[model samples]
Target: MRSRLAARLAALGACLLLTASCTSVSGTGGRPRPTGPGSLWNPSAGQPSPSGANAPFDADAALRRIKRLGFTADDEPGVLRKLPGPLRAIHSHCTGSVDGHCVIVLFFHGNDYVGYDAHGTGNSSVVSQDGTTVTLSYPHFKPGDPMCCASGGTREYRARWTDGKVTFSPPLPGNPNYEEPSP
Candidate 1:
């Protein structure tokens, strides 16, 4: 097995040369080692480290939990992302949707899904997420406003995790179609 060992050594050398780190190969126990800034292995890096919230958000596990909770995109495209704190956001286009989209934010401490942010209007848009805050923008439609352009402009809501729960500043706009409670 000398050739196999030689091949692994060559691969390891290449990996170190490319990433400038050998943590991925040396002693990771098959877990993905954090290679650099913004790596998914350390998705929660640089954020406020609350007690059990520092664990890296696992997008795959979140996706599985989302499907188990009866939310699925089916064949449509969707978004799943890590937010600040132990939070993950899912923007799915097909959850009993007639207009076809909704944003759901979930919180976790390690592997356990703990809570979620209040639902938003179906037409919600994520404006930005930074530090420990996530801002969502929603279009406000006036009577004469066309769907292409809302005459009532847009409203923004900022959400932060505090005291073991999500607190929305100005509160989350109502969701007329929302059903089911957070798991």
Candidate 2:
């Protein structure tokens, strides 16, 4: 019985030592290492966290601003049911220097909201930018068509800063084949 008790104690001491070694090796100084999806350490795990302090513009805030402009989601329950969520819009932001000033072009899914003339048949993209303007291009689609599948044609709208606010110009004709270059 004495020998068995001694062996058990020895086994417990070994386990404690092993655990201590593992804890020491896994120490990230003091900060915990990011382990889940979208972690900076896991590059390929998910969408990389937006770089720079101004990246990945806020879509919710933009939506709120659009709402303030009198746009609202249509009350078609049947259509709303087919959507992924209450907010089906997705957005992207591209930041670059234009005329020596930081310019950010926010591209959002225009089709997610109803009663808007800028509703897109497909996803919008930041096609180009100049010294004083940024252009967003998207396809126009017929009524009741999903923005994913079909488009009537392409349209481009230019956004500019006016009085410290972003304003969009009426859309002009665009080329459907023009792809947005990465920032």
Candidate 3:
């Protein structure tokens, strides 16, 4: 009777061990198979990154390239058909796109510089054109401006990529963030 009891206990221990490991077995003998098209060892060891496998685009370098491709005086002068129409309609039309970014400046006669017309009165604002990134400044409105207080800050408007020069300060009052959304 003692021997039988010992043999029964051993069998129960073996059964418990088997169930503990096999109860949750996915597919392999003792280990689980990958849930979804995965490998246990080195699945991505040889794979490349999902994005930007190649060198990242350099904006500064690319701008230099565009300057190299600058408009040639030899080519016939005409309106740019590719860029989205000017954000602010003026008398002239000259637009260009760089790396999906665009700048539409009023093209004028030889030696003529494109200047800001100051959209009507009361909406006077100053726009700074430094290479790209037009910084629209409204010094009158400090950090406490009604609208941009939380988001836009004191800046009334921000017109970026100003390819042309804003020679005049437009009359800006009553309204802040002068420049309308790029049309």
Candidate 4:
């Protein structure tokens, strides 16, 4: 309908105005505008592309931005609960037994990569685009349970992450509690 088209154009025009003022994309209607050369279009030219690991890692800044979007710390649980999710503390071959399953939770706390829980004690890992290899300084007496504090957990893990699912060694230790990110 013409009204809908006009509304879209109006919305687009307001976006252009905000972009012309070199506004940060962290407020109302906060989508990053595309970069281009026109006076009203190009907010930053020849500055730096704004993405990737090289980008500044500011947890506070990120947290502030996230909060401004009306999200509170407690809201995280509700949002996550609403979504059918992955990245849960679940994975097979967790025990590191000759045949046992394991689970690991990985998160980038402001780009400092950490992996823990349901797996080995957090140490010695090589993760690449191709795959992730987690080697424990000592062998895990129990593959997935780290709190047991049973010492000397050692192993070389060759893990392949496909579509978010992890498949390490076969017979991948069946577990009622284990779930991998959908590969």
**Model 4 error, position 170 (Å):** 5.1
The numbered model that scores best in TM-score is 1
Angstrom error at residue 119, model 1: 4.4
Q: What are the clash counts of all predictions, listed in order?
A: 0, 0, 10, 21
Off by over 4 Å in 1: 1-51, 73-84, 96-98, 101-120, 144-149, 176-183
Worst 10 residues of 2 by lDDT: 94-103
Tell me how many residue pairs clash in candidate 4.
21
**Cα error, candidate 4, residue 122 (Å):** 8.1
Q: Write the per-residue lDDT of candidate 4 for residues 1-183, one digit (tens) a residue.
A: 999999999999988875564323332133322223323212122223245334444344433333332222222433323221122111212222332222233322222222222222222332322113322122344445664353544444443333433444332221212222223
- Candidate 3: give the clashing pairs: 118-170, 122-172, 122-173, 123-171, 123-172, 124-170, 124-171, 124-172, 133-161, 156-177
Root-mean-square deviation of candidate 3 = 25.1
Candidate 1: residue 74 lDDT (0-100): 31
lDDT by residue for model 1 over 70-105, one digit each (tens)? 355332222343355444334433245454434444
Per-candidate Cα lDDT values, in order, are: 0.49, 0.36, 0.29, 0.32
Q: Candidate 4: where are CA atoms >4 Å away?
A: 1-138, 142-153, 170-183
Poorly placed runs, candidate 2 (over 4 Å) = 1-122, 144-146, 171-183
Error of 1 at 181 (Å): 22
Checking candidate 2 for backbone clashes, the offending pairs are: none
Candidate 3's C-alpha runs over 4 A off are 1-110, 115-117, 121-128, 139-153, 160-183
Q: Could you estimate the TM-score for every candidate? A: 0.51, 0.29, 0.20, 0.23
Q: Candidate 2 on 16-43: residue-level lDDT in tens?
A: 8654532221332221112333211222
How close to the true structure is residue 109 of candidate 3, measured as C-alpha lDDT? 14
> What shift in Å separates residue 44 of candidate 4 from its native position after superposition?
34
